[model samples]
Target: MSSLFDPAQIGDIAVANRIVMAPLTRNRAIAGNVAGPLTVEYYRQRASAGLIIAEASQISPLAQGYLDTPGIHTPEQVAGWRQVTDAVHAEGGKIVLQLWHVGRISHSSLLPDGAAPVSSSSRRSEAKTFTRDGFLPVSAPRALRDDELPGLIDDYRRAARNAIAAGFDGVEVHAANTYLLEQFLRDSVNDRSGPYGGSIANRARLLLEVMQAIVAEIGGGRTGIRLSPLTTFGGTTPLDSDPQALYGYVVEQLAPLGLAFLHVIEGETGGTRNPPAAKPFDYEALHRSFPGAWMVNNGYSRALAMETVAEGKADLVAFGRPFISTPDLVYRLSHDAPLNELRADKLYGGGAEGYTDYPTLAA
Candidate 1:
């Protein structure tokens, strides 16, 4: 019987186990959005994960949404990440970088020269974003002109190439949460009328185009994507009355690409997988829609992960907060050892206090 500890393969990457470290934004990058030595130590300590999807990294200067979040655009950032990948690979661990564009989810303070954030429409998210100064209200984003989308796609393409140059095993496109891609996918925010809006096909065009470009730059087997269908994080509510139809179509469209894997956050992003009070969407239906390797995230326990894999519900499971405090998460899960509680106070923007100082079983 297949177990979480059993070996699994996603595309060309071979993992020792099915415990994936979900892309978590630690907000610890140094000035210029560069991953420094501390970032290397943080990931290296957690290299026991079958696969580590590095935090949401901006694809361009305009993509940044938070202070100290890393970027893949500049040469310095690429070199900085090269150290991270090298450390992970040295420990026989696989790592992938997540390409991100915050869109309207960003504050003006985080934007280039205090420029307004950009999105599918001119909507200003009511959600607050973390800036160097502190948490601030998100600014209204300028509607991206139809002509400018190609430039945005190019940014993703360039970032994919940069990930390869940085020695990353692959790249996961961040389409989840309320980022640029989600802003375009949901009708609640997308109010444009053109090839990039209106119909479901139009709304999904940018994501597909970006994926196609990335696949063109790197092979499809080396690329992946993350999607959150029912998440309300960052104030992203479902605008479509039938989210099943919306995400079903999206997953169906993604199936043909033959990418590495599709990572889905089955519940509220960064929240419980099965919230008792909420009427959850039939995530199983969407999981069945994608023919590729499916990775389910959100509030997964060791027993639940093993059960999901054994029952053939998902091929892999991703853990987020647990990884923050347990660097050797796979070992702890495999041995049924107790886990260290994450310091909620130090979840973001800290040096070594709660970052790499989290003791493993060895300590």
Candidate 2:
């Protein structure tokens, strides 16, 4: 049986253990959407994880949605991340950046010149986003022209290259939640006609294109992607009508690319592992289709994580909220120690008080 604490090779990066720190967005970026010194310290403190998937960062300025979320598009942002990557590496940890684009889940105030957010279609989401004015309704988005897709694909390609330039071991494209790529994926949201939308093959085009572009830029070994087949954005969005068919095709297409891993959020994100209203979607089917590490997220307990790995259900288990409060989560899990409760407040746009001040076992 594989142990959760055992070393495993994920793509091109070799991790110390199978306990991964899933990406958690903390709106603490400084000016120019650059991760600051505190950001460096925050990651440095949690470097013991087998793998640290750094918080979601926008691929371009226009891709940004929430206030103060970091971006990997600019030179300054790359420099900012260099410090973070260097810090984690010094601790002998492997870290990867999660490339993001929020789509319609953004407000005008967060965009350039108060521009509308863009999406797979002109439909606006009922979702809200964190802005300078606080939580506000997302702005209506303009449908992206087919001609504009190449530039967007190039943006993702560039972001992957920039992540490599910034000293990251690899990059995880954030196609999960109700983000841009997922927006294009879920037929519930994507309402367009062209090469980018319509049938499952068309809907899967943009994500595949983005993946292929990134793989072409940095090679598939250094590439990973996150997917939330049933994450409903807190039930705000409808579940994809045919998740199994859609994601099955997605993984099947990704099989030949040699991706490092596939991070999947089981059930609703940050909620019940088995959502009552959700149709039964076969997660294992997707695993069999891909020839990469299978990283499962969403409500994973230490026991469950161990059992999954031991049974060969999953290769790596990711913990999100637990890692926020317990920087020494791997140690605690291996020792069966209790975890510190998360500070409900100060999750976003905060300083060290709730960000880096969480006490570890050593402290």
Residue range 1-363, candidate 1, lDDT tens digits:
678888888987888889999999989999889999999999999998999999999999999999899999999999999999999999999999999999988888888799999999997778888897798888888999999999999999999999999999999999989799988998888899999899889999999999999989998888999998777784545545556777888888888888899999887787766655446588888777777778999898889999999998999999999999899999999999999988999988989988999888979
Model 2, range 214-290, lDDT digits (tens) per residue? 99999999999999998888655687899999999999999999999999999999998888888988999999998
Worst 10 residues of 2 by lDDT: 231-240
TM-score of each: 0.97, 0.99
Candidate 1 deviant stretches above 4 angstroms: 234-239, 274-280
Candidate number achieving the greatest TM-score relative to the actual structure: 2
User: What global local distance difference test value does model 1 have?
Assistant: 0.90
